[model samples]
Target: MRSYTADYVIVGAGTAGCVLANRLTEDPNIKVILVEAGERDRHPFIHVPAGFVRLLDHPTVTWRYHTQADAETSGRAILFPRGRGLGGSSAINGLLYVRPFAEDIDSWEQSGANGWNFGNCLPFYRRSETWTEGSSPQRGTHGPIQVSRVENPPEICGAVVQAAQKAGLQFVDDPNSDTRGPSIWYYQQTRDGRRRSSAARGYLRPAMGRSNLTVVTGLQVSRLEMNGTHVSGINGTTSADIPVQIRATREVILSAGVIGTPRLLEMSGIGDKDVLDNAGIKTRIALPGVGNNLQDHYVVRLGYRVRGAGTANERSHGLALAREMMRYVVSGTGVLTYSAAIVGGFAQTRLATRPDVQFVIAPGSFVAGRIGVLESEPGVSCGVWQMRPQSRGHVHLTSSEITAAPTIAPSYLSTELDRNTMVEGLKIGRRIFAQPEVARYIVDETVPGRQAETDEALLQYVRDNGSTVYHAVGTCRMGDDAMSVVDSEMRVRGTTGLRIVDGSVMPSITSTNTNATVLMLAERAADMIRLPMAEHAASTYSKESV
Candidate 1:
């Protein structure tokens, strides 16, 4: 066995791990070991803005985890693609940077995640952000991550924006300002000019040269070494299956994302007793909440054929690619800079007081059958999903082998409320597209088409078509409750020298994209870990980046 010791051992050099490594190593006195299960973020497409679609179901760069076949989704298994390398999902995500509502964070405080309210966490969000549009009382100015507007948006996106407003959806200056309020606006990018500003680029890249930071990529972490209830170290394998042990003198931080975090805990006998028993693993901690409370946004899409204008579908292939290549090389602007979605926002539905539906509009259309292939015709796509789903699910270990994938059951649309939300959300899409100003460009609704007008037909369409927005959260929930896996500071309940600092710690799903909120979670976690035990109990403002 190859053994090494560090002040802190971080598993998974993902968004949260990058933040933790950057912050923890700031004190040079502390030595850190950052491990990842996949290769480095060196793929050409990983850095390009519009090239992310080429990364789906890719051999590397993505951990394409799929759910079990479900009746709710027409007996088809849904693909739950997650980033795999240095930046993790941030490297492969839509690059659309957004934060949840104050209501979402306030609910965290209310739900027993004390001291995690918007007020306490907003400073971290601001500290990590360096907005291109400058600072506001509500927005951050000088930070690591760059948030900017899409420099060159297609005319089709503008028409859709107007159509949403014309259909009675209000436009808010900042949707995070008031999350419940319905709004439509230009989509923001987590890019700085042409490059995707991932967590690795923002946090890890600068810290890579630090003497205290040691990054070990492509290492498959197996399980934690327990000194009683405390995490003493971690054991894993290198590319050649060479055993490696990393002993942590201080703590072991798990930032292996939602599925990986809980799976690691369970493999180390830290999850539910029954689950461990079934998996043939002896129980050590028996935290039932380790893999419970799985939540994600289930989206329903609507595709429309364009008449007067051409979307990316027309430019995604053929000689058009050469033009975009030259355009991007010349000025770092064009269709090549397009994110997964261009324009979208929150909208109201008949079933809820707040804006329950979220829209992500893209200039090009992609059929479900053709995961990475754009349509041959001129088309645009709009994806709408319920902001908050009442349905709950779980991820559990099914085999004793650490490399074996655990069972993922999202239980999508399990409740009538969730099912209705999808149905009504798609109906709202029809209304927006039907607007006179927006409809003028549309030849017709090509997704569900004119035949699927009734509520039942829409519901059937949702069952057959709705898929994940790739925002999985809430397992290993953070709260003070008995069932909560982690406390307010993200310390694993009943364990010392061990903690979870990823999307898995969310008490409930946020009503927005989870990437920004996950960054905030890590920002707060890093601060808590850096402070003394006394100050850790309080909100210590460590705005080093600010």
Candidate 2:
């Protein structure tokens, strides 16, 4: 076996891993090795702002895992694509840069994640991004990630923004900073001009030259090397099936994301006893919450046929596409720079007191039940989902083999509140589309047409069509509860020299796109791990190897 040693071994060079690798390696003496199961983020499309559509199901860049068929989803197995390269999902995600509500961060402390409240987390959130609008009391000025407004939005998206205001929603200047009530606004993206500002580009790229940081791709970490209650390192095979062992002298950080993190723990015999037994793996530590509390935003889309204006469908093909490419090359503008959604915002349904539903409006439509493939005809679409879903699920292993896909059951729309919220959220979508500003551009509703107007009809439509927004979180949740997998400092419970810093550590799903929140989580985690012994918990944050 080929063996290597590092002060810290961070698995999964995704958003969280990229941040951790960059931050921890700041100390010249702290040798860090970042391992990724996928290839390097060198794909040309991975940098284009609009290329995410192509990257979603791409063979090498995504894992392409599918969720288990459940009653809540009309017994359909949904395609769940996860990023596989250095930047992980951030390289393939919609470049929307959105921060969660203060309440969302505060809820972590309420759930036993002490010191993780918004007040404590704000600095980290601010430290990760440089907004185009410059610095303010709530926004960051100089950070690694570059966040800017969606340039030259199409008329259809503007109409949606106007219609949303006409429908009684307030238009906010900066949605990320302001958290008042229901509001509509133009979306911002994680882009430095025309290129996507992924975590690999923002954080990892800057740290690559440092001798202390070693990034190894195409190595899938199968299991942790355990020394009693402490983790020593990890063992895995390269893409060519060559076995490799990376020993972490100080700490082994798991930043493998929501699905991958729990799967690693279970495979390493550190999860629930029943889960390990079923997977034919002997139990080590009985952390029942290792793979529980899976939360994601299940979205219901409403597609509309356009009347006069041309949408992305027309501009993305033929001579129009050529013009867009040329425009991008010359001025870095046009449809080539667009994100998944040109306009997005928060809104309230009749059943909620606050802005419970979020909207992702695009000037193009996809096939009725899926995304990525735009319709041949000119059209627009709006996808709405409950901002904070109460339903919980689990991700568990079915076999002991590391290559076998884990069973992901989100149990979407499993609760009455969840079902009701979705139903009403869809109704709110219809209302926004009905407003004269947007209605003038629409010929008619193409999906779940006007016939599906009633609450029962809308609920059925939601069950039949709702899909994931690609924001999976909370599997390896952090809290002080008996079932909690990690502590406030992100150290894995019941295990020394082990920690988890990723979306999986979120006690609850954030209120917006999860990429920004995941970045913030990793930023804070890096601080907790690198801070002086006197400033942090000496037991969890240690400089020397345990």
Colliding pairs, model 2: none
Task: Compose the digit string of candidate 1's lDDT tens values, residues 100-205.
Answer: 8788889988999988888898998888888877787767888778998887688888888888899888766555444447789777889988899999999999
User: Model 2, 396: alpha-carbon shift in Å?
Assistant: 0.4
TM-score per model over all chains: 0.96, 0.97
Q: 409-465 in candidate 2: lDDT tens per residue?
A: 999999999999988888888888899998988888989888997889988899898
